[model samples]
Target: MDEAALREMLDAVRSGAMTSDDAVAVLRRLPFADLGFARVDHHRALRLGMAETVYAPGKTPEQCAAIVAELLAQPGSSPVILSRADDEQAAAALAANPGGARTRATVVWRPAAERAERVVVVTAGTADQPVADECACTLAAHGFRPVRISDVGVAGLHRILDAVEELATADAVVVVAGMEGALASVVGGLTAAPVVAVPTSVGYGASLAGVTALLSMLASCASGITVVGIDNGFGAACAVVRLLPSAVTTRV
Candidate 1:
């Protein structure tokens, strides 16, 4: 349960509106819920300042739908994010719960409450848009406003240069790229905000399925750049949220 729900429960008990036994019944399934195939963490928002997310790569559409349904049934569950979801999986999830919104490879169930902070998502090229969109969708699910900057790879240095002012205003930045991953370093140099780099598998043979880009990001000369695994847009978004100053107060 979220802090608001917990406080309401306690207040009800204190004011004689609810019995201690009644409160216990309400909190019986808290902390987590087991759904046969998956154990959904119901208290992640309380513990980590963010809710649990569903990664939909290996699971079938039915499995993903079942997990999302369980999460939605909780009393104070935060918005659920389904990352790396294919078209069929997205369709299934949306069919199960019409409240969710879908991008290319990500689905988000954002709550009505909105976050004040904004994050900038910069992609190296058009090919990186999928990963960048995933990062943006994930950030939105976590309550951050994501501003997308597309096709700003190092090859076209002027493109990112033009976005420097805009990027600097964000609470954090997520740079998505492949092929050497120099965009992260460039973005790092331009913005004072924390940079979370995501290397995608968007390059040719020498890229080694983004290993080259991953290594380049890892060895970045930029002062304060961090890197996630290849095509891990969700993880990069989470890192950006963690880096925000108000994340503790804006618990997802």
Candidate 2:
């Protein structure tokens, strides 16, 4: 549970609207909930103002569904997220919790109330849209309105140039790029806000399936650029979220 939920529970107990035993029963599931193969962290939102996200790579469909369902069943308004879930896994999670909202490889439920943070998600090319979409989706889940600017690679400097004013307005920026990955560096130079770079596996031969882009981002000409792993749009969004102001929240 988040601080808000815990506070409400305690208030209810104090007001005599709920019995001590009932409050205790709700808190008995605190810290985490054990479900054999997994120990779902029910206290994450209380700790980080963000809930634990389920990554569906190694887990079975049933496991994915169970985790998402458990997260969705928590006592918070924050959205529960399942990332990179395959069709089967997505189906199971949806079946388990019909309220979920899906976007490509990401699914979210109970979207948090919008926070007053300006964030931007920029894509270097159309091929980088998937990574950008994931980043935008995560930002939305966290209640940040993401400004999207797509297909603005170095090949078309004019495109990014035209959006300079918009890019400069964000509290944080996430640049998703492949190839030489110079877009991140350019965006970094354009805005004083933190720039989180995400390299995608959307390049040819020497690009090394995003390794080259990752390296280029690491060696960016612009100073103070934050770079996440290849195709790690989620991490980029998390980086941006961490930089935002924190408040007590409930588990999603």
Candidate 3:
């Protein structure tokens, strides 16, 4: 339960609108509700700024559905995000909730879409789209409308420069690149917005399975770019979300 829901329950009990026993029944599940296989953390949103996210990498479809359902059942101002979902996981999460849609790793509430801020997701090539999509979708879940600029590898500087208008208006940017990871540095040089560098495993042998890209991003010449792990789109999304404007919200 969130603050508003908790307050409503308290008000009902104190005003005799709800019986003490009924109030107890409602609040008894405040912290969590056991589902045999999983214990859903209903109180996470109260402690953190958002609800507990679903990590669908290793979880079964049923478990992901149950966890997503439990999180949705809680009242909160922010939308929910599920990260690292493969195709099957994405399908399962969508099947679990009628309120959400298949968007990369998770589904989000439709009303929350209006609050989606502006962000730019720059990708080096088509190979990076999956990781780029993960970042974009995760940002959308956290209320950000991501502008995608794909196949703009540093090999052709003009391609990236062409999208300067969209890049300039963004509150933040996520750069997903695989090879030398030079796109993040170049984008960081062009924009004042926070740049989240995501290195993907899309390069050849010398790329060392994304390790080269990861190290390149970590050692970027750009002054203020932030580097997440190889293919860690979720981390980049969360970092951008934290920088979002703070508005007081009523939670249930």
Candidate 4:
């Protein structure tokens, strides 16, 4: 339960609308809910300022639906986000609660009210769109509108140069690239915004399945560049969310 929900429950007890015993029952379930296959953390938002998200790689569609349904049932729970969800998993989640939206590899339900702060998601090339899309969707799920800057890798310096004004306005910047990951350094050097770099597995064999890019990002000449694992768009987005001010993040 969030602060608002906790206060409302206390008020109900004070006004005699809810018995003390009834309030205790609700509080008992606030910590977690056991679903046999999963123990859903209902108190996550209260502790972390954001709800727990589901990672759908190894889970069955039914399991995903069950977890999502339980989360939605909690009183005052924030939006539920599912990352790396395949088409089947996405369909099952939406079927469990028809009030949800999906992007390429992400699904969200009851997204929190959008915040005024913005995040910019920049992709190195077309091959990076999949990872970039996941980053954008995750940011949206967390209540931030992400401005997408596509195909702006260092190969065409002018492309990224053209986006300097747009990038400057973001609260944070997420740079997604493969193949040496030089884009992160370039974007980092150009904008004062905090940079969260994502290295994708989108290059030749010498790229070592994104290892080269990951290493390059780690050794970036540009200051203030943080790197996530290969193809980990979701992680990149969470990093950006943490960079936002408490006023924008604390609400959800």
User: What is the C-alpha lDDT profile of model 2 across 1-252, one tens digit per residue?
Assistant: 777778888898999999999988878888899999999999888778788999999999999999988887777666789999889999899998898899998999888789887898999999999888999999999898899999999998999999999987889999999998999999999999999999999999999999999999999999999999999999999898888845653223
User: What tens-digit string does per-residue lDDT give for candidate 1 at 1-252?
Assistant: 666667778999999999999999878878888888888888887777677788898999998998888777766636787878899888998899888987887877855266787788989999998888878877777777788899999998999999878987887889999998999989989888888999999999999999999999999999879899999888898897778735344634
Candidate 3's C-alpha runs over 4 A off are 1-26, 86-92, 109-113, 249-252
Worst 10 residues of 1 by lDDT: 243-252
Against the reference, the lDDT scores of all candidates come to 0.84, 0.89, 0.79, 0.88
Better of 3 and 4 by TM-score: 4
Where does model 4 exceed 4 Å of error?
A: 15-17, 245-252
What is the lDDT, from 0 to 100, of the residue 219 in candidate 1? 94
Query: How many clashes would you count in candidate 1?
Result: 0
Per-residue lDDT of candidate 3, residues 136-192 (tens digit): 777776666778899999999999999888888888999999998999999988888
Best by TM-score: 2
What is the Cα-based lDDT of residue 83 in candidate 1? 76
Query: 1 or 2, which is superior by TM-score?
Result: 2
Q: Estimate each model's TM-score.
A: 0.92, 0.95, 0.85, 0.94
Cα lDDT for residue 208, candidate 2: 94
- lDDT by residue (1-252, candidate 4, tens digit) is 665567788999999999999999988887889888889998887777777898899999999999988888877747789888999999998898788899987999888778888789999999999999998988888788889999988888999999999988888999999998999999999888899999999999999999999999999999879999999999998888777834623654
Question: Where is the poorest 10-residue window by lDDT in model 4?
Answer: 243-252
